[model samples]
Target: MAIRRGRGVAAINYPTGMNLGGDPTQALVHSTPTGNFMVTLSSVDLGQGMKQIMAQICAETIGVPTDRVVVDTADTDTGPHCMGTFASRGTHRAGNAVIQAAKEARQVMLEVAAEELEVNASDLETDGQGNILVKGAPQKSISIFDVALSAHFKRGRSISGRGMFLIPRSYPEKETGAMKPSTCYAHACTVAEVEVDDETGEVTVLTVKNVFEIGRALNPKMVEQQLVGGSWMGISHALYETTEPYYPNRDHGGTDFNQYLMPGPGDLAETEIIVLERPSGDGPYGAKGPGEMCANPQIPAVANAVFDAVGVRIDTLPITPERILRALKAQAN
Candidate 1:
């Protein structure tokens, strides 16, 4: 038999934030005398660029450049309380907290700058380059560093603020199980193209095309990287990874990478991603988390593609050749 090619598509909706006590997260923001700002949080990054995303959120909220915002995360003993980083809550929860704290700190900085310039705080605006200027009179401006020095040395005020965000938990109707568990949901659709060898039952993925409505893209590059990595992880799980070769009689299982099988770069399919921004009401700057949702539709799409290719329904995981061939033989019989 000849090799056959097929395509399949899938769509998924992924929730952001969890339902535990409304999934609260806190942030602390303060300005240093050197004019830099720091945001402290207990949420861990876990290689998902939490620090960079939070810094972008804080800088945008406080009207400063991202470089001026430093994110200090993962120090539980020193940082404020946070729900652990998982379930796609890092950006939405922590970013909102930073927004609240940075807003307050920015207000304080404006007031201090107003006093120094003999102007009303409402008439002052920051240039986002460490400078505060009188609105409509850009020529009359003061460096944020000078204002910070005056705040600490002359005004005896600390430019610090604290903030916390908690989504209100809702009681689900016992009969319907309907309740708001997440503040926002990210959506994605994926289409996978694959070719299957009839004789060998081997599948080769040719391409994966994805479109995501992730509320916002605080860091487009990071979003792209996540999609690339997550797609591959999905591929590995769908076709190459399994721990229990024999369930009741476990074998070939161990605690090392050598014992595990996973797809590498050679297995990656060509990917095309389209990001759509439909700002969420609850997220900071309308940014719904993107890390977890990247892989949501990939596995199903690949599985569907396999079915389309071979006209057989092999439901088990890894879709090993033995299973495919067995399904084919049954179909023929």
Candidate 2:
């Protein structure tokens, strides 16, 4: 008939991309007439800042300002082929493809600037400020806008490139079950503190602290927002969300969104996250995927916290009050 507090910790290692018969992604980079670069891909953004990150990657690879790059993921029909975005592969796979395309387009851009400046392409360099200049003599430079105009009207050249990335499938050895399944791994640990009401069997998550090793943070702000929002989703999956209440007999189940159960704003816990960078060689700019792993560790952490608080191990999800009370009653007997 009193409130009890407890803490628990959980750790997990998640894979970045699955090795599904050479998971492949393609990208196309081309310069517009206005000196802007367009990157076309089939990877969906899913509101995870995919477009922003891809644009940043393209701009960095092509030696231009981030604002000058645009990512176009309009649809699969127009864009290049991509193994659908899942298994946290969007950033790692599609980013590599964009880098390849941008590099090729950048080489052509340097060549175009070389032709205009009457210098060898090897002697040219990009200042990343919309200017292509000679390596030693910065004064002998050509603006990207002028270069684009020349390429289109004067040179009759297309500053465009296409690229695709695929990880050749590694078949398992016969002697031992050894094979490469994922491109890279991300690790995370979460500590959850919870308070349980012995009388009502209700659990209140007090705080959740997470530490993640996700290679590199392409966009720090976006990564932080994803981690924070994902923690709330983990909490919801642990103690609130359920599609079927009466399983084994599909007689009673949620029919619509209104019938579904989930936690409200008031039920959210204070969350703290710390990101660690351990760059992966194969990843794009040493950046791995933090997509699904962000919400993984918190589930087991909360379950362990509830067990620590009530001295009862509730294995099922949602951790409803009735289940807790029944466990308590059985323990008493």
Candidate 3:
């Protein structure tokens, strides 16, 4: 038998954050004596660049340069309260909290700048270049560094703010049972192309093209990396990764990495990603979570591709050659 090529597609709509009794997150924004801003949170980064996204949000909200902002993911003992980072809620929930806190701190900074410049705080605005200037008067300005020094020594005031974001829980309607489970939804579609050998029962993935609507891409490069890496994980789950060889019988299972099966770099497929931005109303700066959704569609897509190639449906994960040959043999009987 010869190898047969096939293509299949899958799509999904993923929720941004859980809407459980106001899943809440808190943030604290405070300016240092050296004019740098600090954002303290209890949410862990988990290597997903949460710290960088929070820093960008805080810096933007406070009208400061991103480099001047630092994010500290301190533990619950030192940082503010946070409902642990899950359900892809880090960016949407914590980001909103950081925005609120940064706004309050920025207000105090403007007030301090107003006092130093002898102008109304309402008329003052930050240039995002470490300077606060009067509207329409570029020459009349005060540096954020001087303002911070004055606030600490001369004014004897601490520039700090606290904020928390909570989405009120929605109750199901008594009659229709309608309820809002999430604040927003992110969408994605993936098309996987593969070749399957009818005789050998082997499958080779050729390419995976994905399109995602993630509300907004705050950091395009990071988004690309996450999506590409996630697609690889999806491919692994679809064709290679497995620990339970004899299911329903727990006797035979992979106990170590050497015994486990997974795809290496040579097994990776050619991946292409296209990002679409549809800003959410309540999302922080129109940004939503793109956490695990990137790895979802590829599973079903690959499964469907195998069916199209061999005319046999394989429902189990890590569709091994033995399973494919069994399906083919059963079909031939």
Highest lDDT against the true fold, candidate: 2
User: How do all the candidates rank in terms of TM-score, highest first?
Assistant: 2, 3, 1
Clashes of each: 0, 0, 0
TM-score of each: 0.95, 0.95, 0.95
Candidate 1 regions with alpha-carbon error over 4 angstroms: none
What are the per-residue Cα lDDT tens digits for candidate 3 across 247-319? 8776657788776766677787889999999998999999888988888899999999999898889999888
RMSD of candidate 2 to the truth, in angstroms, is 1.5
lDDT of model 1, residue 185: 96
Candidate 2 residue pairs in backbone clash = none
What is candidate 1's TM-score against the reference? 0.95
Alpha-carbon runs more than 4 Å astray in model 2 = none
Candidate 3 residue runs with Cα over 4 Å from true position: none
Which lDDT values do the candidates have, in the order given? 0.87, 0.90, 0.90
Ranking by lDDT: 2, 3, 1
For all the candidates, what are their Cα RMSDs to the real structure? Answer: 1.7, 1.5, 1.6
Error of 1 at 42 (Å): 0.6
Instruction: Look at candidate 1 and give me any clashing residue pairs.
Output: none
